[model samples]
Target: MNQTVRPERRVLAQRVTLAHGGGGKAMRDLIEDVFTSVFAPPGMEDQARLMDASLLEPGAELAFTTDSFVVSPMEFPGGDIGTISVCGTVNDLAVGGARPLWLSAAFIIEEGVEITTLRQIAASMQKSALEAGVRIVTGDTKVVGKGSGDGVFVTTAGIGVIPPGRRMLAESVRPGDIALVSGVLGDHGAAILAARGDMDLTSDIRSDCQPLNHLIEAVLTAVPDIRAARDATRGGLASALNEVAYAAGVGIEITEADLPLRQEVRGICEILGLDPLYLANEGTLVLFVPPDQAVSALAAMKSVPAGRGARVIGKAVTAHPGTVIMKTVLGGARIVDMLVGEQLPRIC
Candidate 1:
């Protein structure tokens, strides 16, 4: 009797293994069935297609940025590594006075990680991209031996369009320009530290991880003469200000009382013996605007949800060029020097 020759059934692997990273059928299946499936819907040009590179419109000035997120705990209050991956790159472009457009993400995943976890991260990235009004057009994935890597690490690169007549840069900052911060400082760093649970500390602080492109656009529209803008990521507000001062060949003076510090963040810093100025922030930005336009700029920033707590913190000056000086509440002034080393590592 000619019995039907049944084809061998292919069983899908339940967990990632070393074979997944190998450039073979197992790796191909992992990419196609896992990462690509999650990031690209059916009929879409999948990132697995591996195009040489994405194309941009000709003759358009572009702002490009890249960042990597390796924050421990993977998940944290208010956001996670996935969300930060998108916001970090988007904010970099926004601070350059550009409108974010496209993003590319790469993942380094450790073997044995739950596929469900990866899916959740992909979903988060999609939601953040929607909110930020950007597209994730390409990506890559690699798996390492279980003990050789962390659960997952994400790196993202972004492209944006620089609007005509908008030229914000550190070198553009001038004496008499006012400095402004988007919101309360050190929330992200404090949140990450608390999330670690190492010190047995508990707090309601959450990472301020959000896209600032819209807020930046609003400020630029209202104050077209903005001199420079920077996101306070690593090294926090102090590092950002010092870099700007050195680049512009000017000094900066900020009033301690004018700084917006949340009570929770302040408490955490005091307890940990850390300075909020040097802590990292994911959603905060520092702006330099002409003194005359400072009021309008502050108002414009406050109009956005991300910048509702915006404040004019300081001003650029000619004396002590290339330095940042902070006026204390005790009627004294102290130099806010650039951080000699990292205070909080992997807080981003």
Candidate 2:
């Protein structure tokens, strides 16, 4: 018996060039051979032609969000810029009770970056999209001079649908609602810091980069009256809690001991004089659930892989409305204000 060999599909260019951004054969070949090959977007058109049966349902609304990823290291432990682009955009919609359906990815490639890097990132994007049950329906690519841009920057726009009778907003959080985190905090920031190797730090920690749509769905199903939710991204959990507290006009009192933190992440923050609560997280989200439904919500979150560490970290309070306070283990309290300045820059 003889076996057939399939030729590896790849672009001829070893490194990206300005010519690849020109509207010519080089550009077409690059797009066709590298990106579209992996994404398999429906048609070769300027915009995606999209339709879904859910759109016809009465009271359903379309959700749209866009974000850009420019992490210092294009590839980091457990994730890359491409993976973050997809997960970040998907999560923006998921936290709002939207079912992600489609995404549009645009790449800004710096000349001299290896074509292999782009290929790897594109494949990662497609893999994440598949896992999130969404499609990358359209995209654009451009190359710049090496000094004009970073190795690569990715911008993603996501579209999702919110079914009828589902409305979640930060302002919906009541005084007695509980605040919960989907998983451990500060993993992404810690991972990126270690990967940069600038501070002579090392850790086995990997980025908690994952799409939270499924986890959010699970929680919503288990507790439909979730008041508010937000992903802990650039500004981390502290910022997210502050935003929710401000929007809902309630004070959020959290127990420092109850907040989940991995040992690696805590070590990194302590050594660097940083607060883990203010470090970024790509896969974690904070949500407010009614007190009566907190048990079910936590159980639902723990049921999903992305949310195994889910737990109640705090609760809404009427005192000090629009503030976040942390109860220290030493029988003391302090305000956990939003991050004052950039703690870790380019930490998607």
The TM-score values for the models, in the order shown, are 0.91, 0.97
What is the Å distance of residue 245 in model 1 from its true position?
Answer: 0.4
Q: Residues 294-324, candidate 2, lDDT per residue (tens digit)?
A: 9999999999998899999989999999999
Count of backbone clashes, every candidate in sequence: 0, 0
Candidate 2 local Cα displacement, residue 109, angstroms: 0.7
lDDT of 1 by residue, 150-170 (tens): 899999998888866679899
Clashing pairs in 1: none
Instruction: Supply the global lDDT for candidate 1.
Output: 0.87
In order, the Cα lDDT scores of the candidates are 0.87, 0.93
Pick out the ten consecutive residues of candidate 1 with the lowest summed lDDT: 47-56
Q: Which sections of candidate 2 miss by over 4 Å?
A: 1-10
